[model samples]
Target: MTLSVLVTRATFADIAQRLHDHFDVDDNPDDALWDPDELKRRLQGKQGVMSHGSDRIDAALLDACPTLKAVCNVGVGYNNVDVEACTARGVLVTNTPDVLTETTADFGFALMMATARRIGESERFVRQGDWTKTGIFDMFAGSDVHGATLGILGMGRIGRAIARRGSLGFGMRVIYHNRSRLTAEAEAESGARYVDKSTLLREADHLVLVLPYSASSHHAIGAEELKRMKPTATLTNIARGGIVDDAALASALRAGTIAAAGLDVFEGEPRVHPALLGLSNVVLTPHIGSASIQTRRAMASLTVDNLIAALGAGPQAGQPPTPVNPEVLAARLR
Candidate 1:
């Protein structure tokens, strides 16, 4: 019998064709977002699944799909899946990493610049017929990006890339706060100095968040954290939603707790906070940190490689490239 697999979201046509050639593929070309019950129903009889960031795979879903052996996520972040639950049930979990690092970093830096310079607001001013009446001086004057202090909240691959861009290209001072410090060589390459979280908040002219989301990290930047930041500082988040409290962020923007903010992800996305809609100081975009064509294709290709290997097929069978729970495979061998 042929192995069965499900693609939870619509992907590039070429990637879909490759999946079809390998397994009994069930592709959702319409790209309809399914509720948990609907997703569980569709997953029945499927041995593997290709998932994106929005899909939630937890203990309950795993229990319902007894035959599931592998889950390959197209994005680097796996916060949507319960890796511990999958491991307990001997299910393999894999994610695509490294391929999206540079692209995501580029977007993060761009968002920061847009927020600091009020680029989005200025564009709107021009389109609104207000620019014709105003003089160039004191018109849409905004903060400078060059030679500013750039504080990063997570010094991972994407964070390091952003640091290099700030330090080498823009002559900005880069400081970061990570769960653990990077090696001396790594810091020297990125030109980032490690600092405590409080110092990072107090000193940075522009702050960027690239941390992962978890129960402990939820609302990591809340009312108190926002208050700690300089009144002139600009905040940018290209990381996952729910990492910052949206309600508090909206209030902060309104009160000028910070000069401006740029958010690519939000709490309960596709449904943004109503208060944020009216704020002129915030620049918002749908989650597209890694939306560049080349990077997205590479991510999809890596996911396919992981799925094929995890299902005991392809050239690298039994050696999935990026397993989140390698202990599960080790247990199976024992």
Candidate 2:
């Protein structure tokens, strides 16, 4: 019997075709945003789903969709899916990782550069016909990125990539604080020094947040933490939403608590804080950290690979490449 699958959002035509070849595929061609009930409705009778980061899968959805045996997330982050719930329900969970790491690191650095140099604000100024004077000494003067202290909050793959860029390419001082310090060899490779969280906050001229989001990380940078930062320091967050307190960030920007900020994700995304929208000091981009065409295709292809493998079809019949719950695969063997 052919397994059934659902593609939660529109993807590259070829990705859909690959899934179609292996399973009974149901895809959302219109790219419509479905609510929980609508998603559950569409998920009915599907054995696997190619899910987007925006799609939330929890115990409720798992309980509702009994046939679901695999969930292949299109992004590296799997916080959108409830892995514990899926594991308990015997559903295999997988995410596309490594393929987009370098791409995301590239974007994160771009955002930081744009923020520090006031690229976004200057572009808006030029478009608004405010470029009357040339070479004014302090006109739109911004912070320098090269040779500045680059503070990374989470030294994961992307964080380490950012560190290498800052240290090797830009000659910046790389300081990081993670759950655990990287090994001596890893530290030498990245040229990063591990520091306490408070020191990381206080000393960094440009702080980039690449930490994952969870209850402990929620509002990790709030008003009190904002106060601790140097008045000239810039904060960049390419990490998940809710990692920084958005309202507090806006207030800090208004009060000049920090030099500026660049944010790719937000507390309640798709609906940015109104205050941030009005501020010229803040550079905001819709969550597009891993949005390069080549990277996105790779992510989609990996998602398809996981779904095809988990459903007992495809090249790697019984083994998904990046399983969040390998125990599910083991259980299948038993």
TM-score of each: 0.98, 0.99
**Tens digits of per-residue lDDT for model 1 on 99-142?**
99999999999999999999999999879988666456877678
lDDT of 2 by residue, 204-237 (tens): 9999999988889899999999999999999999
Q: Evaluate candidate 2 by giving its C-alpha RMSD to the native, one decimal.
A: 0.7
Considering every candidate listed, which one attains the maximal TM-score?
2
Give the least accurate 10-residue stretch of model 1, judged by summed lDDT.
131-140
Estimate every model's Cα lDDT from 0 to 1: 0.94, 0.94
Poorest 10 consecutive residues of model 2 by lDDT? 14-23
